[model samples]
Target: MTKNFNDLVADLSEIEGGYAGHVPPEWLQGRTAYGGLSAGLALAAAQKAMPDLPPLRSAQVAFVGPIAGDIRIAVDPIRRGRTASFIGSDISFEKDGEWPMGLRTTFVCMGERESSIDHVSHDYPDVPPPDIGKATSRGQALSFLQHFEFADIKGNPNQGPADYLRWIRVAERDGLDPMVELMLIGDALPPAAMKLVEGFGPISSITWIANVLTTTPETDDGWWLLRSRSDYARHGASSQVMSVWNTRGEQVLTGMQGVALFL
Candidate 1:
């Protein structure tokens, strides 16, 4: 069945032990579901497990195996403290009954805590607005790309400093929970390894670590600025840094991903 971004997130429902959901093939990168979908669902399950929990402080996800078809997600609380709670989540494809993907995150509901320092030293990059660029067309190249839109802001990656900037958003309007939004957009960028080569190639993310600065920011127009750069790529492995900024140029989430470059 065809499902939009909201539909996809809506399908995730809290069950007795955890959550249950399905991702349509339209969002599949290959035989496996899109990395963001799996991660987002896991985070959603985490949210359900701790509905009154605090905002996400840090989250690490390891893609143990392909998560596709129907699936069951279970969340476990590692530890709960007054100010912070650590959570662990796991997902298993229902068809096979073998759990693979796993996520661990720390949430903090900082109330009126006294802090000696508060500062943001980083600055947002200057880039053209999303409307000024053309919508990226993967052209049935990958069924997954159809659900979202992209505007390429930089040219060939191999010819430059191996940095990529783009504007991305879902085609359909969907109200996503805060944690769910962070997980989905954090993995939206095409692997930075693609810039290390002459053209497109196969790449799979083995591990992803996202540090959410705050509750997911509300998107005024649903557009997010995706900026990514690869720090190193060697021996069939690449490490890249990525960030998702809202339309107002605020850094909502930052992450690092380790990918297996098949090229």
Candidate 2:
């Protein structure tokens, strides 16, 4: 059954030790849930568990195991100070017989403060605005990718340079929180280094580190520019640096991801 992003999150239940949730069959990436969805839920749970937290500033996600059928998420407050809050989250699911780790995360939230320093080292691509009329399904993406639409896409998976640039957005983003929305759409692209692969193969996102530039960042019709490039790929792994920009050309989130490729 097809469901919106919000619906999947609403399916979560706050249990005793943690929260329980379910993923629709279509959202599965290989044997696990989409990296974005699973990670989004963990962040959502943390927001629900503690409403007093400030805007999200940074986050670290470890895709430790696959998450299908059912999910368990637990969030603990590592510290809560005057302006910044640090919280950790753990997501788990049962496999054949044992409970394996699904996702482990740490989120940092901090309010805006008066500062003489404010800058971004990354540059927004010189591409024109996303061709709204050209947004369409590539049809070659994973099952969960059907939930999104891409435009102004650049880069060929069969070619080199190892990068993908596109404007992407959720089909249904009404009523969704900004941070939560960003969390789900941030990792929408495939691993950058995969561009050099000749064929599709097993790929796992091992870790993700994200730095939020603005919690109030917004884009036209929910579209965000996603730019990712892999400067290094070796043996059986790849590391990518990414940046998300809103329609206003504002940097929303800067992220780094590690992927394990079995190609």
Which has the greatest TM-score? 2
lDDT of 2 at 215: 59
Q: Could you tell me the lDDT of residue 251 within candidate 2? A: 86
Best by lDDT: 2
Worst 10 residues of 2 by lDDT: 133-142
Where is model 1 more than 4 Å wrong at Cα?
Answer: 13-16, 95-113, 132-142, 155-160
- Reference-based lDDT, residue 187, model 2: 91
State the lDDT of candidate 1 residue by residue for 230-255, as single tens digits.
Answer: 88889999898888888777888888
Query: Candidate 2: lDDT over CA atoms?
Result: 0.84
Task: State how far residue 96 of model 2 sits from its true place (Å).
Answer: 3.9
- TM-score to native of every candidate shown: 0.86, 0.93
CA-lDDT, candidates in order? 0.72, 0.84
